[model samples]
Target: MIDVEVAVAAHATIGESPTWSASERALYWIDIKKPALHQYIPESEALRTWPLTSDVGAFAFCEDDSAIVALRHGIYHLDLSSGELDLLAPPPFDPRLFRFNEGICDRTGRFWVGVMFDPVAPAPAHQKGHLHSFTFQGGLRCEDDIAELHNGMAISEDGKQFFLSHSREGIIYRFDFDSALGGLGGRKDFAQIPTGIGLPDGAAIDREGCYWCALHGAGRLRRYTPDGNVDREIKLPVSKPTMCAFGGEDLDEMYVTSAAEGIDIAEEPLAGALLRFRPGVKGIARSCNTGAVAKMARVAKRRID
Candidate 1:
């Protein structure tokens, strides 16, 4: 068994979206229930948190040192230094019913984000969720297929394939992607996890093209090959490992985030802590948003000026 250690002994409610900024040499993640963005600097063992007014699901770093954030009401451009938010796109569905969930930026600078039924809202007989993409040239494009909860979102290294997970169904779906036109086709089942194991959550792709995913309820992380075969798995100290990301000066360290919101801390000591381990594999640098949303923010600022 690979040894894992606790990096941050945080009591985050719903820790998710572990992203590494190579330029900054820091790891940034979100606490969904707490509605905050956290930055951890490994070299200095320093941590900084920026409080947010709305619930945030996921975010991607931008080339301008800012970030694009998916919040409860809509997507926004976040000023990391000031903690200010500028509206990029308003939520298509009613905010009371649906909210943005998982998201990532592709090599072509298109930000793909997912929507899911809001748990705080009254339960409906049917759930509503969809996959959407945002770009500078095109505002927002929504996919037709729907699901209850959209979790794990990752893209292949060549940018020819997209992977997404429906947590309620415990299935991961793959789509043939058109990078030039931002299109998704050839949708099919990539993999499935038995309910007994755990529902798939956030995911990241490694240099070897293997998908690393956190098993939400099972206290584990798994590596799935390009062909969707499980090649290895690691047991986590926490039961609700929500997401994993590869980061380090060398990009060989795997950092995981967990949830402690509704968990019994007495039973699960590291339930909300950030955990890390060396997975013996280096990860490719993640693509950054090419200042598209930041451009929008600048436009808005100019108009106001």
Candidate 2:
């Protein structure tokens, strides 16, 4: 495998959520601490950004050229063309206690988002991260009370499996998924990173049903087979890779986002830049939140009318 190379020297503070838009042929990601959504067009080397009001955890593309964004306060509809944000739902829990974290859409177009206790807020005595799902037909619902720092959210290409990670605890979990009903069960440990090795961050599923995950603090991307065996590992130049996704025309090229938060950039030069490399396997195309934004818009229109 080729060594990972810098794709964008964004220097994002808490870069996360590397998402590919095949329709637009651009890669979108977020800088959480900076509070912005960024679009990078590799073809033209052009970059565009939409400044967000609050820290955005993650987002999923909508069928109608918009995006459903999970911010600190609520989920919102972001019109990509006009940069207008409209609220879709309020925070599932008290905003002061929890803030959205990793999120992705399933094959059935349900947006699944995870939430963690806000470190900036006062200590909530007892709190745990939770998983939630949202649909146009069914509103937001908290599905599971899962972890402390939820990350590494991904689903298999065949839609039969789901993976989630508790970053602080260094455990990646696998669950049997019912795509039709958006159900999760049969949870078990997929892998665990030892204390000095790395913490599982963001993840993606390849065409071969293998799991590709970024190892934050370890500076590596590890691929695991369907049977929970390590297949391969690729070292990255930066120590804090936050997320990875496949994006090139053929879906063989992989993109990674990193964080520079609380780091001495002078020592780690490429700490926050977006990186790219080839893993010799294509990735499953990301599923979008089909018609959710459009449906919400129609509802608001009828109310206005």
List of clashing residue pairs for candidate 1: none
Residue 32's C-alpha lDDT in candidate 1?
87
Question: What TM-score, to 2 decimals, does candidate 2 have?
Answer: 0.95
Q: After superposition, how far is residue 100 of candidate 1 from its true place, in Å?
A: 1.1
TM-score, per-candidate, Cα-based:
0.94, 0.95
Q: Which stretches of candidate 1 lie above 4 Å from their native place?
A: 293-295, 300-305
Q: Could you give the C-alpha RMSD of every candidate to the true structure, in order shown?
A: 1.9, 2.0
Model 2 over residues 42-69: C-alpha lDDT tens digits? 9998999999988899898887878888
Q: Which stretches of candidate 2 lie above 4 Å from their native place?
A: 124-126, 298-305
Question: Who wins the lDDT comparison?
Answer: 2
In order, candidate lDDTs are 0.85, 0.87
lDDT of 2 at 226: 89
